[model samples]
Target: MYPTHSLLEKIKLYSIILWPILVTQISYHAMNVIDTMMSGRAGTTDLAGVAVGSSLWAPILTGFNGILMAVTPIIGHLLGKGEKQEISRSVLQALYLSVVLAVVVYVAGVLFLPSILSLMQLEAEVAYIAKHYLIGLSIGLVPLFASNVLRFFFDAQGYTRITMVILLITLPISAFLNYLLIFGSFGFPRLGGIGAGYATGLTYWIIFGLSLLMTKRIPSIRAYRLFSHWIRPSLSAWKAQLALGLPMGLSIFFEASIFSFVTLLVSRMFTTDIIAAHQAALNFSSLLFMIPLSMSMALTIVVAYEMGAGRVKDAKQYSWMGIALSMLIITIASVFLYFLREPVAYLYTDHPDVVALAMSFFLFAIFYQLSDAAQATLQGVLRGYKDATVPFVIALISYWGIGIPSGYWLATQTNLGPFGFWIGIIIGLTSAAIGFWIRLYYINRRFSSLRS
Candidate 1:
């Protein structure tokens, strides 16, 4: 039994731990929502264009983020084990690696944007709009990469508040800029959807700059040179990180791709109203999903630190605590959203048909949050253990093998329509949650045995 004072202390500590993460998550999702709202004003075609373009971009971009995720645990472990110099070396190397990877991905995305959009079977006008947005957005990849590296570094050092500060500054600036640019306010040109993309790109640079400045202020971070003799990438280290990162990257790709793919798949079966409704519901779900997502990030840091310090019991306990907290928070959020689904759907658009469709999908979303929170937490636990491949395999099998096929069958082969597509998401997420939890249990057992 815990003492009341001790329990209060733990609550305070956890709140401090979660606050920055929560802020960052909220800011990021808010930016996305603002972008969507701005784009919707341009017309449904514009909205659809951004949606499809975003789907194509997320898997590729987030795959890179997955690589950065690999770095966090490594840095967290090193920080915990008091390998300050090694942490510095790894971070510098990771920064360089991230820049290189971002350049490659950006160039590839720009060059292929037209081709990819063309292949997506979008309306011609929508394709044109999406391509323009993608072109402007692609240029900011390096800055985005840099920002992620800084975020991971701070998170690893248990200084999550820096990200919150940077995001607080960036989010409003980005939204205001987006408003000005998208609507021709304040003497800014109305580039419409393209303007939103430009605003986002500029915001990425701002975040990168702010993160760099804050990073320089940290005594632990400032002790090492940004580019020193130890900054070169070790082939062995790269391989080790890749070995751990690739699976995680693929897992993220699989999961993000499923939603993205479903968006496209639904478009094939339904009209733009249905597609718009789906997007609105998805956007809301994604935003709310950030709560669990932040919890996952915090869990990774805490669990990895404990594990690295050889406190196996503490690590296990921390992971479980994080999961419980995430579930409770998400459950409440889901309930709130469920009760307010129609009003929430109206926030995206005024179209009655779209609102109705969105409200219908929200019912499915309510189910998704529980499973999604569970899967995300377990994935974080696996990250702490540096075990990625099994989860990746599980995501692929569940998402592709079960989720997509069922969605295709239900939406096309059956009569469930757009709701059927959401059912597919429910199935995929639930399966992933169960699979990941089972894998975590076995891994935890093995880890405990070894420790004993």
Candidate 2:
């Protein structure tokens, strides 16, 4: 039987794994914030272009990456069950899946993005920048997906700090590249907002190379033989991963797409300044989101590890611990947002009206912070139990079924205008929180019965 831990021991274990994951997560989200901030400094059109491009890119990337998130639990399960030999095979299959998915995403983005952007009625320069920015960013899809798989593989084995170190090393390089490419400094071409995309792409390559090196160089990880053997592509392995991953992917897609759709809707209804402001508020909120997001990720690792070891009680306790920690942290962040909303808004742009409007959006963002944290952490808990399909259905119903339509009706038909969408976001997230809580309760009972 697996050994159990006291609450304090669990807390210590969780924090050790969590802090690095948190930093890595914060660093990743900060790259997007950096892109928005630097692009804004370039000019209004550039900022709008990057914002629009990011809107189109975010959901797709998040959804696709969500599919790869399966690697964590799969590998964690193997490790927990003392099946170390199987880890390499799982990683290989995940790598194969990543390549296929990346290619599909790239080809689709290349072929269909222009047509979609055209329908948006964007300004000429904004359209041009947005289109090419996506093209540049798309170039990195292969490496980005590949590196993420490796990251999950490492994190699953409790090597969260390895990925964290890799990200920290690359984060500043991404910023410098953005500076040089965006402003045409140091003899680089002045691609403006488009450069941000290219810089991001190049950074992906660097990150991938470093990740491969880590797999080989790290003594403990090297034992897994991730690189030493070539495993042929296997259809059965692919199906096994997709069985668990697809619903997880779709659930994430539904949630992320709602925000992207909201941005698109706002673009159709408002001016470039308004879109930029909306993006600014969205970007900063996304940054704060990384805190809970990281907690959720850690929860997935911890919970899955416990479950794989047949320690259901420990997994349950850890899940609650993660949720409580997330709530406490988000409460502090919301207060910070409330007191410094204007300054935070101004960080994105100098335009007085945009800053004022963004500050207003921040208030709505603050309202949803608690719900967002609760739902995100709860989803992470559910993922630990390998319960994804129902969350996908719930996300579909709450986000598209309830959230978007209500937001649209309020935005166009009522007095709330753009603000109505934010209200919709709050409503949707609150619904998700409640839904996930109920689901978790039932799942816990089911697991408990099985244990008895």
Provide the TM-score for each candidate, comma-separated.
Answer: 0.95, 0.98
Q: Give the alpha carbon lDDT tens digit for every residue of 144-232 in model 1.
A: 98789878888877788989999999999999988888888989998887777888888999999998888678776667666435545
lDDT of 2 by residue, 1-452 (tens): 12347999888888888899999999988889999999999998899999999999999998989899999888878877999889899999999999999999988987899899989988899999999889889888999999999999988877899989999999999999999999999898999999999999999999999999998899988888887889899999999999889999998888889899999888878999889999999999989999999999999998989988989999999999999999999999999999999999889899999999999999999988898999999999999888899998998998898888888888889999899999999888888888999999999999999989
Q: After best superposition, candidate 1 residue 143: deviation in angstroms?
A: 0.7
Best by TM-score: 2
Q: What is the model-wide C-alpha lDDT for candidate 1?
A: 0.82
Give residue 313's lDDT in candidate 2 (0 to 100). 96
> Cα lDDT for residue 82, model 2?
90
lDDT of 1 at 94: 75
Residue 124, candidate 2: Cα error in Å is: 1.6
- Count clashing residue pairs per candidate: 0, 0
Best by lDDT: 2
